[model samples]
Target: MDAAAEPVRRSPPWRDLLAPGLATLVCLAILLALGTWQLQRKAWKEGVIRQVVERSRIDPPLAPPAAGTWDPAADEFKRVRITGRLLNDRETLVHGLAPGEAPGRALQGYYVLTPLVREDGPPILINRGFVPTELRNPRDRAAGEVAGPVTVTGILRASEERGLFVPAPDPQRGEWFNRDIPGIAAARGLTEVAPYLIEADATPNPGGWPRGGQLRVDLPNNHLQYAFTWYGIALCLVGVFSAYAWKRLREVA
Candidate 1:
């Protein structure tokens, strides 16, 4: 007798795939949304970089905006010129890391923030620059602290926000992690201080101890790569579902 004819196989009904199909659609939508959001972020970051370059590289620094008139958003990164006398007595040193000549290397140090006493307005914080651990004391670099009036030209910057892991500042010990402007001002008994600080350019100080010109604008931008990654994952999911459905339909009875 001839072998019994094998039963023919057929695709499952649409109703059988409804639940899985819906789930796949939802996942794809989520992934696509993430990819789109990253693209938008990429555009915003580009605009920020352009603005920084334009505002920071202007020739012949612009006048420092009048106190109470300066807005952080509009004036940050602007190259400004200010005439003031350095109040070397009340300087604050905020901990930081300066970029080293070798790639991926950083020199751990402190930023010298001296209050500039301006005749026209309130005291403004001036970030003279990074000084190594050895020169954290004023006596080590005493000559750099000029006694007479001086002209400072540098980029304006907003006060830094402390991170979750940053250490709390100790005024008594003179230990600081982030540049907390209000906190620093209050600690030093300064009132009506400028909301923003100035990062001085590479002008040579008398002793060249607190090296200036440490304004670094290095915003990370990997949105394009992230977008591609999300889209690729979604594509793979589609391929996997297609293969699974094909195998199920071709099963022999």
Candidate 2:
């Protein structure tokens, strides 16, 4: 065959590449979109983390706003001080997991939610802190329950919604799966209770049973890593399609 005069090699037919080309384009679009979405999420998550730190770390905590006065979006995680008598007798234990002694281990336990009876406004629910499965009973940690007028300084939190997998609370057994504030108030025969809970700070109690400071400020932020992963996959996909198209065109030629 003459080098220049012989029949010139032609590219693959449009029909042959159309379906795969369209499929590849669709996949690339999805992958790129996912990666971009992750970057946006990264920015949003960073803002949330910053807000939590700023709000929760304010010194000389302010008093909580009255009913219908506070906006949860604006006031959540704000450091607040409330002085009242803790109704230890009506405390509710919500199931949870706390950091164990060893690293990367979790201890099965419950958060003690007790009502703080203020003199003027409605009583507020305070997440006193975590207690292991062994100290689930108030009697076991009786001395820790300080009586009389007491002041609590901690981060304000909104009511927690139950997860789909979470079971309904056993009122008879006084066991709760999640922090349903209204349910706890009703069960405790409390009226006009505050709509939020306060996660107490790391202040040591007398008996040192119900450990305080359970706010999970350090939220998992792996969106950037996820974005890179998606982009990497998209790049590999493009390289594979290019190789496949090149092979097909050469075969036809």
Candidate 3:
């Protein structure tokens, strides 16, 4: 047969690609959605970081929120000043780590969370700071215990959420694995306790037993990296689908 008269090769019908096209579109939509969501997350994380940095740098702390006006979301990381007497006898020891005197080493310690009864509002938990494991006994750090009414300035923090690996608190032994404000309040028989805890500043205690100022505001912002990863996957999927479609078309032609 003459080449001109021979049958003209044509690409596969559109119907043949209906299933794969729909699936590719669905996958592409999902990948793009994930990438967009990560971008939103990145913006949210940046805002959060900015708020923390700005709040931390401000001086002349504000007064604690009055009863019925406390909002954990708004109040967290806020520096507040409170004048109250510490209930040293009823202090709770939460397992923690403190910066050691030497660099590159951490000392195992417990956060000394003592109750401070504010003259204006209900009692609130104050993380007086980290005490060495050996100084767990209140008697050992008697000098650091302020006698008269004291003023504490620190950042307000919300109760921590327990993780799957977090160990349960031993109320009987006064051993706490997490900063569960409610649980600690109930364990210490505290009435009208604040919902949040105050992380005390770096004011030197008398004996320097409990080192304060351990609030770490290092939040990792990797949303941009995650967004790029998702977008990369989407590009790969497009390339693969395009190559497959081109090969099929050439074969049909």
Candidate 4:
């Protein structure tokens, strides 16, 4: 064949990449948006941690909120003092894990939640503390069942939201998974019950079977790591797309 008569070989049409290019652009936008959202979450989480730290630093326990004045958002984590007698007969045990004697170990237990009947006000629930599985029965820890007028100092907490996978509480069987305040009050036939609960301090109990002061304030802050992951993916996508486009253009040139 004569050189001048040879047919020209053209590259694939640019329109062939229209679908992939649009897809890449959409994915990049989504990844970038996700990264930005995570950064906003990081800032929000930092603010929450700061608020908790400040609240923890406040010395001298504040008085418990009165009925009709209770605000979970405002009072959560606030240390408060209450003078009342514990109604141990109506105590509830919620499944939990507490720090064990050995380092880095956790003890499977139940949080002993008892209602405290105030002399002049409605009764309030108190998380007396964690009791090991073996000491779940009140009879096992008889000495800790304090009677008469007594004072309790602890941090106030709001009712917990049920998880999707959590089983419904069996009040009849005395089995509880989450802290459902209203449900517990109803089960115990308690009237004029406070809306919040208290996590007791490390004060010594008679037998010390139910260990107090297990309330943890540490919240995981991993938004920064997630943000970085999303941002990194976006960068990689851009680099890969750019390289592909460059190679395609060279082929066409």
lDDT of each: 0.90, 0.91, 0.89, 0.89
Per-candidate TM equals: 0.91, 0.93, 0.85, 0.91
Sorted on TM-score, highest at the top, how do the candidates line up? 2, 1, 4, 3
- In candidate 2, what are the lDDT values of residues 32-53, reduced to their tens digit? 9999999999999999999988
Candidate 1 to truth, TM: 0.91
Q: Runs in model 2 with CA error above 4 Å?
A: 1-12
Residue-pair clash count for candidate 1: 0
Q: TM-score winner among the candidates?
A: 2
The residue-by-residue lDDT of candidate 1 on 1-253, one tens digit each, is 9999999775556655678889999999999999999999999999998898899998889988887788988899999999989999999999999988899999989999999998888899999999988898999999998889999999999889999999888989989999899999999999999999999999999899799998886578899999999999999989988886666656632
Q: For model 4, what is the C-alpha lDDT against the true structure?
A: 0.89
State how far residue 52 of model 2 sits from its true place (Å).
Answer: 0.9
Question: By lDDT, is 1 or 2 better?
Answer: 2
Root-mean-square deviation of every model: 3.6, 4.2, 4.0, 2.7
Q: Which residue pairs come into collision in candidate 3? A: none
For model 4, the stretches where C-alpha displacement exceeds 4 angstroms are: 1-16
lDDT of 1 at 75: 92
The prediction achieving the highest lDDT against the true structure is: 2
Q: After superposition, how far is residue 79 of candidate 3 from its true place, in Å?
A: 0.8
